[model samples]
Target: MRALGPLALAVLVMLPRLTSAQFGLLDDGLTVQTGREVHGRWASVLHLIPETGRFFPAYWLTYSVIWSVVGTRPLAFFVVNAAVLASLLAMLAHLVRLAGDTRVAVTIAAVAFALSGPAVESFYTLSKAEPLQLAWIALSLLCTATAAARARGSLGRAGWTAGAGVALLFAHATKETSVVLAPIALGWLVIERRAKPGHPCAARFAASYLGVAIVSAAAFAVLRWRYAALPLGEGWYTRAYAFDAATVGPALFRIMAWLVRDFAFLLPLVAVGLVRDRTRGPLLYASIWMLGWLAVYLPWPATFEYYLLPFTLGAAWVAGIVVGDLWRDRAVTPLAWPTLTACALLWVSAGINAAADARVQLVVDRANGQLVDVLGGLPRDSRVALNMSPINEYHFELPMHLVEMKRRPDIAFVRPTTAPGHQGETFLVTPEMANPPRPTVRIALHEAAVRQDRAMLDGLIASGAAERVYETTQRVGILEFGIGRLLCRVAVAPILDPTYCPTERGLIERRTFTYGWQVHRLVHARPIAATMRHGG
Candidate 1:
């Protein structure tokens, strides 16, 4: 047990370094940037609005206040995250003590998850809300579980239930998926009640849990209503990633593959725990919470790695039970050797993960430094239009939401058009290709232009409309002759050019719209336009 404590400490120390590669410390960067914007009293970008209370001023203010006092360095953020994770570990250790085998429980929980790829990804990546959400979830679980072990009718049970409820709201606000644990927490309270009939503690716990649930749900409803983000009346099809089952199946398969690759070691342990305790309500609740989330996620077309984060706690708990059971099994011959082998495997995996994680940290630091360089060069209060969504980069630090470039009438490289006829006086930009995916947000521009009922090519080439012309480089720039308004759109992802429209070659050859803001051939840049930056 003593050795395990030191081992866990070592893992915690190394976790931050290991998990930094793929995701980087994104949340901190985002929060810090957002905090600066907040301090500056600027309105957040439309996309940056919080749908839940978790990201509201209260939570952000806490982070901002901490930053003000401690200085806004990455290390400060890392320390906070590390401390939260360590506290969760300590809570798990307390649970182990409650279960009466501190050593085995601690080993099982720590080994199964701390070294898993998901844990590394969720905890190490700073920009993601997952770690913070998970921390609150863990705290909630710990509080509820501790209350569950007490004798029925204990006087203090109500407080623990209230604490769990508060934590639940915090978690929910942090991430919507954290709601999956509600049923589990409720079941924990219910099961505990069965052992202490007529006990005031049991009733109070149940009441408190129910109260918390109602309050959290109400608060969320109010928030969503305020933001007009309520799911009500919005068909499932309206969701960003909700797709038909046929499409969802393939995406689900990919997500499953990712899970397998990242969680190979813990899978067996979780399976064993589930198979052995199918009827235990808490166990079943955990399994249901996990499987239920997977089922729900399977139908989403836009599932990402961060979506799998909330399940880490449930998975770790099950893994711990499975490992403890495996250790106690008499049928397993040479138990010492098997246990030692497992430990060694976990240690090696942890070490390899840690090294890889350090490399990730290096990438994140480099990216962050470069991003700061980019922002620093921009003049203060510059009406900068981001050609792309800044959130795509794990460690991107642009104050995109607060830039107020939307009102400046510059070509918003993203989509370049709003709703129908909302293209404003600014020229709406579009790829010459006929079909553009929603992923590019090019659909919005195309749809809007179509709604305007303009002959596509003719509108682009019309007098006062933007004229297609060549630029100095290979990048294409529309030169408006009639009106002084010309738009140059640049795509910077996996570079795409009309020349490579694989599905439709003729779409680019057609000429319809002439570039100009006026009615006829009018003004042109001193030189003819030629080149356009291909969308990456």
Candidate 2:
């Protein structure tokens, strides 16, 4: 129990490098940090525009500082992300202890939280703001707990309260969903003060928290007004994918289903803690924290797995409380066996999911490495057109930045639209303009897009419009498992290449799962025109 915290810290410190082998600065990483060069100013990185309504000024500033110090080294970014995640995990353990959990329970729950499927995803995609948001949230909660423990009306209490408020502001700045933290903190304080009726700092702490929320809100509004082209309701990105009123019910259902599917074991423990410790102020605070995130996510237009990070933390804390109480009793009952079994199964499920993710990451890393090699081999003056998904572009951008290439000015990167009947137009790869100075090199990256636009790729190859420069291939193994069948599924799935069913007899399956990239060099005009005329 005593060594678990240190062991967890050591593992977290290495997690970024372990899981991020294939990851590169892409999407928000580029749009928010490296890609700002396209707009010719640092202000572009702020992204106050309505297209991205989530104004993360603090996040951008942090990246700017990193960029200045590290000059776009991918490892530097990974280190910072790992550090933040480790800090978040440490804070989570401290929070569990504050809730009166025993050391063993705190260690177990914190380890579970770190290994939770969603947390693994966050670690893998370290470029996103979710980890940073989690860090700020944990920090705020820790500050609130510290303030609650301080002497009434003392400077220590006041200072901790102010720190909590500042942390809350940064959390919101990292992600708009963190606005729930303010109310969560207030609720926690209310519960704590009620438990200790004579606490002199209660009123003052509440008022200070409220003042912080008000100031944060006002500051956010001013920034939005000054920089955003439209309000949240008017933003295209928000309306299209994030928060559509018409689809809220279905979205909420899907999100809930996802939670149940991923965290079944942890959810039951949380429920037990909530019922068992309902009267305890700290337990109530944990419950409120978990519920607050659910309330925010229910109406969200899209509920990505990463959105479950905060909820996972809350659940872990509650589960820790329940386990701690049980451990203190020191009695093994009939129900204890099943409870222990469920916990074991939960961890096994998480381990399997993490392994699957790591496998996919390795495949991606191989593909990205091949692409980088091909790109590096191209002529220094080549003007290449990138016709791929945003994710693929980000993968490419990271390596380019690391190598400090001067190709950004010459590269024409286009993220294809997924709209119907626009597949050909999306690539813009025609035989007519297959000449120099107009993308002499074209790369078909991302397997899904390649599969979708196979005809276009075939046409280019057949028409002699372009010659294949490089290619690479890899296979993906998909794992399927359910309750009471995980161990069987793991044992049989890899060896037999079949969907493992615990009871079903001899159900073998085979599927083609290959992903890679293909590069083509534009041919001279004469051959291209002749090939096109003959409908090659």
TM-score of 1: 0.60
Consecutive 10-residue window with the lowest summed lDDT within model 2: 432-441
lDDT of 1 by residue, 1-536 (tens): 65456345645655545444221223455565566666644333212443422233335554655555555555556666566666666665565554445367667776555655455555555555666777776677567655655665676666676687778777766656555454644654566566435445435444455556666766755664565343533534335445465546555554554444344455445444545532143355456556655665665555554566556556666556556666666366345345545544644443343334333334334444443343333333332222222123321333431232112223232222222333222222222222221111101123233333334435435534354332111112221111000011232222222212223222112212211111111133221111222121
**Cα lDDT, all candidates:** 0.45, 0.56
Give the alpha carbon lDDT tens digit for every residue of 33-53 in model 2: 454452346576466454755
Would you list the clashing residue pairs of candidate 2? Answer: 26-394, 242-301
**After aligning candidate 2 to the native by TM-score, how far in Å is the CA of 1 from where it should be?**
11
Candidate 1 lDDT = 0.45
Predicted structure 2: lDDT = 0.56
